[model samples]
Target: MNGLLKKQFGLVLMLMLLAMLMYACAPDEAPVDEGGSSDEEESSSDEGSSEDSSNEGSSDGEISGELEIQYFVGGYGDSWWKEVISDFEEEYPDVSVTEHAGPNINEEMRSRWVSGDPPDVVYIDGAGSSETQMVEDDQLMNLTEWAEGIELEDGSSLVDSFIAEPSTYDGELYSLPLVFDAWGTWYDMNRFEENGYEVPKGFESFMSTMGEIQENEDIEPFVTTGQHPYYFSRGMLYPAFAAHGGNELLADIVQGAEGAWETEEAEEIMSNVEEMVDAGYVDSGLGALNHTQSQMNFLLGDNAFIPVGFWLPNEMEGDKPEDLQYGFIPSPMNPEDEPMAIVPDLRPLAIAEEAENPEAAKAFVEFVFTREYAELFSEHTGAIMNLEGVDLANNENVPEYLIQANEMINDPEQVEIFYKPHPMSADLETPISDSLVSLLLGNITAEEFIQEAEEAAAEYREGQE
Candidate 1:
């Protein structure tokens, strides 16, 4: 009887040890929900969830939803943007797209914001207008999160060269930089060769050539419109400002500091403008002219050089005289200062904060960033592709000087968005531009011009506060 009892005890001990080992290795299932269940069962159920968490689906795919996009395309003046949108619709069939043309895009957007009805995605001119204000107001989406998963064509950062930090606010990206537009001096090569003049090397050389052309060839060396201040700010004045001071002046001005325009560095710039007026480099008629008039003169070859953007090729298309060999160069710089290139203004598309289909808007931005769409845009507009790894087209329409300008951008040391950083306001560029025109027309002395500009700038700052 004692031996039988000892055997039973040993057998029970072995069974208990075996049960413990099984519990350690096995996954716990959901505890049978018994209101009377012990703590041990709940602990067992929690352990089972760890394995399931690791198996969650992580596949990436395009999503679909109702999306509304408001785009302004007056400058493009063609089917290019329309075609691209149609292509987007076909590619993402499930995404229902509603398109509204934002007439007077800036004013329309401002009105819509007041009415509390803004579009999901919209396009605004990058000529340093009201778009920057929207970014500051946090009206745009923070695209960094959405861009992380994207793999660009070259397997690099999704937002490549032209589309990066310029749209950033407080270290977070707000909008996408779409097509790149850089301002420079557009020229007619046929006329240049015909006149037997070497391309101007620097500011002095350019002015000398302009003088010679005016005196000998009887052509308007340069033509500009002073009626709109943007022409002066972007095309003539700002470029000269960057040339004189190493591009930091504008940023300093934006940050409540004086710009080089008020410093000794600006003497060369102001002197150049004064010299142009005295020597007849620019048309004497510019006092009443407008931006379109400047481009019109260049296209007619009545003016040899016009300050404009790469988009001039598209803008001048039908109006461009036959056999017009047009090209572009960096706006003439102060000979001593290091060369500075404009960070091409990006035609960014931003999703409104209240956008009903934020995901679809983001997806559209992603799709447009792809090489196919980027290349399509470049081809259509004769504009540079914003995507990485895509080569600048060597087509018949691309001007040689534009190619040279693009080379200047390759140097990381020289290219920057310094001048373009100012947020748009009715009070900012307009007042300064008018002051510049006043200086040109001898209505305001240079010192008076500087003081008035500073006063207007101070008012803008106060409004912001």
Candidate 2:
């Protein structure tokens, strides 16, 4: 009986030892809840879902949506747009872009804008598009905050990169200046050199130069369009006004202040035009010509100098003579001592107030304002972008005249740039343009032009009231 009891104890001890060895060899079990899922497994599942949510659009968390862009086709053309869009797609592969662009895009997109379902982005240029009107109609998004702190790829402030700041209303930015265009006088360098003519420095030099050109060259010394008299009024007269009376006079003229156009400065500018007309330095047949016709005449060597924008070369690219060498200068409307004044004509780019894809729109805006794109713009458009620090002089693709003009534009000592606080109303501009045509044709005196302009300003103000 003692031996059997000992055997039973030994068997029990062996069974207990086997159980301990099995427990040691088996895998560890996690703490499980009532649902049969372990805590560790639940945690891992939650982490995986979080990662997927973070990368919904792309692995790098890029925005993905339909981005509609509206741009106008003009002298700049649409090649740059196509290339940039392709590049943007490569950067954000998931985003889809739709272009609403053409020469008449402003008119074509009018209905969409009126119905409050405009495209994501809009380039305010060409006919039928006015940035001021858009602001009044509440069609643009306020980009002041986003623009203030935005940075370029090289760690420079985006706003600081602009050659000119965007126009603002009530201290809020609505549009960015995308194109850097300035009104100035254009001539053929080769023609001037052949005639031994010098570029004018100021009003006095301008008159003398015109006289010299008139006496020597068979071509008209100066030419401007009557159909678009703003070529003279805004291009030459406005800059002269600023140079004479500074920004204060410009503000008054823009506001249509009573007799603003009859100031001493205005009289002097009109008198200068009168002097040119009386001397026969002005083209007598301009009253019958439109902008393109006048420009064509200038390009054909019928005229020695013409007032126009930087787009002249690009606009007349196909028609320009092979021997023609473009030359540009700010209208020498200032006195001999004062620096030349530049009136920059900025084309604005805006975001719609009701964009379907705000993120993509903002992203595109940021993407477009880089130096790389600015150089591309110069390469494709043959004109400068609104960005600062673009090296156009060294670029073989850029025209030599544009390179020289850009240097003058950036030199503060050579030029003083200014803008009117507001755009002139159609009512005000129409009569001014008409009177200018009459004045240039030698039918109206300087005093008469001023009287007509002041009367028009009064009428515009009364209509506004």
Q: Highest lDDT among the candidates is held by which one?
A: 2
Kindly report which residue stretches of model 1 are placed more than 4 angstroms away from their true locations once superposed.
1-62, 126-129, 160-164, 254-256, 336-340, 394-426
Compared with the true structure, all predictions reach lDDT values of 0.65, 0.83
Please list the residue runs of candidate 2 whose C-alpha ends up more than 4 Å from where it truly belongs after superposition.
1-62, 422-431, 462-465
Q: How well does candidate 2 score on lDDT at residue 397?
A: 89
**Model 2 agreement with the true structure over 274-298: per-residue lDDT tens digits:** 9989999999999999888999999
Which 10-residue window in model 1 sums to the lowest lDDT? 53-62
- lDDT string, candidate 1, 5-93, tens digits: 99999999999999999999999655555686557644543442345422111122334555677776544554666787788889876
Report lDDT (Cα) of residue 40, candidate 2. 80
TM-score of each: 0.78, 0.81
